[model samples]
Target chain A: MRDRKESTPSRMAAVWVRCGPAALVLCAALVPLAAPSISSYIFYLMFWITMASAFNIIFGLTGYLPFGYVAFYGVGAYVTAVMWSRLGVPIPLSILSGGVLGVALSLLFAPTLRIRGIYFAIVNFSCAMALRILVANLPEAWTGGSLGISLSAIYNPNASFYTMMALMVLTIWTVGRVSGSRLGIALRCIREDPEAAQVLGVDVVRSRLKAWILAALFPSLAGGVEAWYTAIIDPDSSFNLLITTKTIVYAMFGGLGTVMGPVIGAVSLYALDDLIWGKFPMLNLLILGLLIVLLVLFLPRGIVGTVTRRHASLRAVIR
Target chain B: MRGNSVILEVKDISKHFGGLTAVNRLSFEVQEGTVFGIIGPNGSGKTTSLNCINGLFRPDEGRIFFRGREIQGLPPHQVAKIGIGRTFQVPKIFKRISVMENLLAPVLSSPRTDQELKAKAREHLHSVGMLEMEDRLGEELSGGQQKLLELVRILMFDPQILLLDEPFAGVHPTLKTLFYKKIHELRKQGKTFILVSHDLTSVYALCQQIIVLDQGEKIAQGRPEEIKRNERVIEAYLGR
Candidate 1:
């Protein structure tokens, strides 16, 4: 298992860069004629995948636990909603502002970024809860508060899914490049030993802060897309711990540090969600919690780790 | 000071851990091309001095100059960008990362130069005689192998002066001699080194000059032969 390197397939890695948007556009083009149920599920998975990938950047590779990821998600949703519904901003403009909000929140979280291991994890969770409560207490007239805001619906599922799919591909491609770059090496170093990385010329705190900001970008943008898709949102739904938990679990399932891990994890779990979730909706969460527990227990390295281990054992037996 | 060209200088560096001083106003100069050994008893601040120089620790007082530039208060990565390389006391080899990959890691400016980094990495691995194991994971390597790996990794930076903490620690006898031989070759080629070691014999053999730190202060600084005859060093190691 030691020598079993995951040679990241250039073809698979380039798929998003080359043809993801085209594929999404093709699928979105067909969505108008397709079944509503299938289209809704497709949009849900497509949007959430990007959010999961962003979470993977911080939580996976850097191994800094974040509980506040959904705070960014909620911010994106509400920003998009307030802009589109009240300000009459274009869909594109509102979502772009959503990305900006993500960057802002990531910056705000910089002070807390210095905390490592479990302490940092708790701070993140606390921030998410605090944001949720703050939104709940805000004047209903502004946030629509408990009632949330109902925006003009985009009837074209094609547009929503295509945009979402494009965003997802953009996220995957950007993260791949970022992780492959010097910044990624710095992050991995910080994850292993902040002190050692520092001595070796890695600015541990700065790198983590940069990662913190980038991580917030996608989840928040996904939140924007989600608000548009559902046509309305509430603080409870927008800032749900479920969003945070699901993204983290997905990344872990696929292979946290590896670039494609989130995508793989998202597809598999969402498939399971689609198959059996209707019969027992709570199963969606129960399965995630259970899978995370089992994966942590038996396969600390996750999917890629396990696959590599198997390959090594096979080689050992042959040798 | 005017007689020699100083590549790296620790200017009155001191580190306080609450009330206790770990490195106490210690200062030293590393010439552009010489092996400087720091020999002291356990808890004598050799590691702390290196950390301060590399920007891991911001000293309570003093400045560090690298290539005639102030680098004391700067963070570690910036220090790296300005070109100082280091290896840990216990090989901080990224265990999951491959041997060759470890060498390629410090090229933070460029992720892939393809042929140049690979050729250099391969050459380094070959020099350490670990080229055959270039693809092996760091954790799989033996103690001697890890030290060799770190030596090669540091070379990736092509640092003007290298800070190595206990390069000979825990290595096999034969490999220890081989490691010293490699260092001699680098010295002959005009590379500088700041080596911290408890191995006085190793220090005596390799260092042109020796700095003996005692209780966070520089107790003696001179040739290894003079340091060996110094009463304070004898008293520091074995009470007067």
Candidate 2:
């Protein structure tokens, strides 16, 4: 029998193996911020990466593809706006409150966990749409109704960009920690077979809830930052379904379950979107649709997933 | 069998799916440290009864008691935490993860440190002669290997009662003998087992007490020898 104790050096080595690439990527992202000409685009890349990584926590790890993930983002943005405008809370604190609100709103939909597969996705999408309409029709006094909130007083693109960059790093770190933890293993087991995981002593509901809450927090924080960056938000913009779709596409395009997959997917695809969106506005959608189709058909596992499958040694380092 | 004390008791449990009665008014007692065999023809509810005992399915009627505490209707994870470990009929191993990961999952839920859990996982995998394939993905394993991995994976929890559903199905003869030996060794260590299998020879050899079911009803219950001669069991196996 092998020894039951893992030596200290081996544990340290495992940590280094996981965190090294993440640190390098964080440094590379930071270096690009120095170039002001494309700082806005950098912010966009960071925002997408953070959002896609967050989406992956639930969809990739636990196999719960939440179609209404943007609901949390919209809720976070509105919560931050309300806190800042009505209660006169500071920008940073309001953003933090937005994350908390994201978690709270996710709890409201926690019962949907009982529903599985494509049904859950449909129900979640409906809930997001319902929430959007409810916000739009609410009395103007509290929510500003369809008019939305304008925080031009606190609008600072540079500050918001830096804040988003920090959040992107945090999101990557969170994914790394989760992927290496026991909770990650339980999540994967639940993804594979919930009944089997339960019989093996994994609390399926609780593990999934944890992943959901974590996933909610990231997009919520990102939304709060984006709201401040834009200085104006309406119900249509706040609860945009396109954000949810784009996040899912980016995560899938990069790979699911690995730390670098969402990052790679978001960076490559967001850049392509930026390049083509202005010149060929109508063709952008068609091109994205074609790319996603091709990806699904030829590279179903995404870039990192395909690479890892082909090379065994790279799996430990990349993940 | 070392103890006469009953470790698990099922009392008049019934489970139904729409018009189909999968398990009907079945009751059984499993003594501690004994191999209790459950044998029935296809669709006879052997798997259903096991599912009920392990909390995979809630009984429509009656109750299940594990170590004198009612366990029926509890979630599967709660049942596992209460010391009931089970394997599925088709060997539901986590296909995307490594064999080492498969073994570590149950122990991770326990209050064990990472080092100790890894060590325990390695030890279990070695014991099952799968140490060499520890890093391979679960799906990469052959059918017999997957079954062995599933068994060893559950054993990591140190479960008091094991509900093994057709552990011998599709397994190699050598692995089958190894499984039987392992079950006997575990029994010797005071672990209780409710084995559901279609392999009659091993079932007859291993179980001191056996039950026969037909059409979701228990038709006979006795020692293997008596069960062999029972007319209803003969009719159930060979058809009327």
Worst 10 residues of 1 chain B by lDDT: B106-115
- Model 2: CAPRI class: medium
Q: Could you tell me which residue pairs clash in candidate 1?
A: A1-A312, A68-A124, A201-B77
lDDT of each: 0.79, 0.88
> How well does chain A score by TM in each candidate?
0.87, 0.90
Q: What is the interface RMSD, in angstroms, for predicted model 1?
A: 3.7
Please state the CAPRI-style docking class of candidate 1: acceptable
lDDT, candidate 2, A1-319, per-residue tens:
1223344535654576567656755665675457764777777788999999999999988998899999989988998898899899999999999999999988999999888899999999999999999989987876888889998999888788879888988998899889888999998898889989999999999999999999999999999999998888889999999899899899999999877889889988998998899789989989888888998899887888887777644555566
TM-score of 2: 0.94
Error of 2 at B222 (Å): 1.4
